[model samples]
Target: MTDDRPQGTFVLLDLDGTLVASAPGIVASLRHALHTLGRPAPAEATLDWVVGPPLRRSFETLLGEGGDVEAALALYRASYEAEGMFLSVPYPGIEDTLSALSEAGHRLFLCTAKPLPHARRIMAHLGLDAAFEGLYGATFDDRFDDKATLIAHILDERGLSARDGCMVGDREHDVLAARRNGMTALGVTWGYGGAAELAESGATRLCQSTGDLAGDVAALLRSETGTRAPVA
Candidate 1:
């Protein structure tokens, strides 16, 4: 039940695909941006990959090398702020899993590629803000657009070490970032990134459902701290 490690464990969670199914809002906003820029929007099915990566990078992929990524992002934000952001909803059993993790004494933090302000708004909208001790995200100007940079920032700002933490997300970016920072990566298959992607990205563990996720997290915490979790 109690952690034996000198420093308690922490978890960095991704926002879009991991916690919230934000593809609807994100895709709509992307479409809005493309329309505003006089570009043809791609088919809806093709946009699933857009949910986990940085907005600028996604826009760049759609708009090409010479595309005005900033402009598209600006337009996307305008629409997203007005009508699309709240179009998202949390994944099934996400709140319960988060509560269980928090109750188990592990510190949780939001670390996402989305802009900080937007990430805050999304969490507040979902009433999940209280579940996290802190939220670390990319800047509006895309300064920390990649998962590695955001994770590094969180570690530096909190005076935490990767050895005492892990990253849970649905994308390869998250797994790669965690590895790059010397932390374990937990991949969830219920999100956008499928099992193959997680496996190829070197996820320390792959969770098939909320129950699986919670169990893995508990096991990892116990393994790291050399203590057993309390039976539920």
Candidate 2:
């Protein structure tokens, strides 16, 4: 009883950890912000954990309970916007995957918890702005609290039905958002989230590598329609 899209279709994608790995720059910027504001930096190992969700929550986690969350958040933004975000870079092979998807007659859009400005900047920095027809994300006022809500907004903006599109990401948050919107959820293991997390998040399928995505996705969506043209 799973509803899926046709072979050549639009796919809403998550940014950080999914399409790119912006950890080094993000971690350094966050550390500088925390230090400047007299807060302890989150352990290095856990820095990338902050990439997937909204920045405010990442700041909150870094600040810990009873910490000056607001001040820390302000400092975090100052550093991140000024330079922290530029540290982000797209994962290798991503260009090919995106190009392949587009050339095959599928539309690509971005769906991320990252702020509109930051997401836009990162996309442009990575030469990815043109890869998508639409870039959907939250404003600075809202954080990455609810992926479902964001997905709903994206769907509304595009005048899309759940059966016409799919969601691709590397986190449980991404999968849950797709399911919440009744869209097909596809997970990638090369990003922050692993296979177990994706499965638990109710993803329709998993792509082990970035390259596996185009084919598996073609198959999954093709199966949905009971017929499909060659993806190439």
Tens digits of lDDT, candidate 2, 1-232:
8554345467898998889998887778778878987776778787767778776787777677887767776776788888888888888889999988887667888999887888898899889989799998887678434788898887787887777678899998898778777788889998888899888877788898878888866766655742112111
- Those runs of model 1 whose alpha carbons end farther than 4 Å from true positions after fitting are 1-7, 224-232
Give the TM-scores of the predictions, in the order they appear: 0.92, 0.88
lDDT of 1: 0.86
In model 2, the clashing pairs are none
The 10-residue segment with the lowest total lDDT in model 1 = 223-232
Top of the candidates by lDDT: 1
**Each model's lDDT:** 0.86, 0.79
- Of the candidates shown, which would achieve the greatest TM-score relative to the real structure? 1
**lDDT score for residue 119 of model 1:** 89
- Residue 128 accuracy (lDDT) in model 1: 94
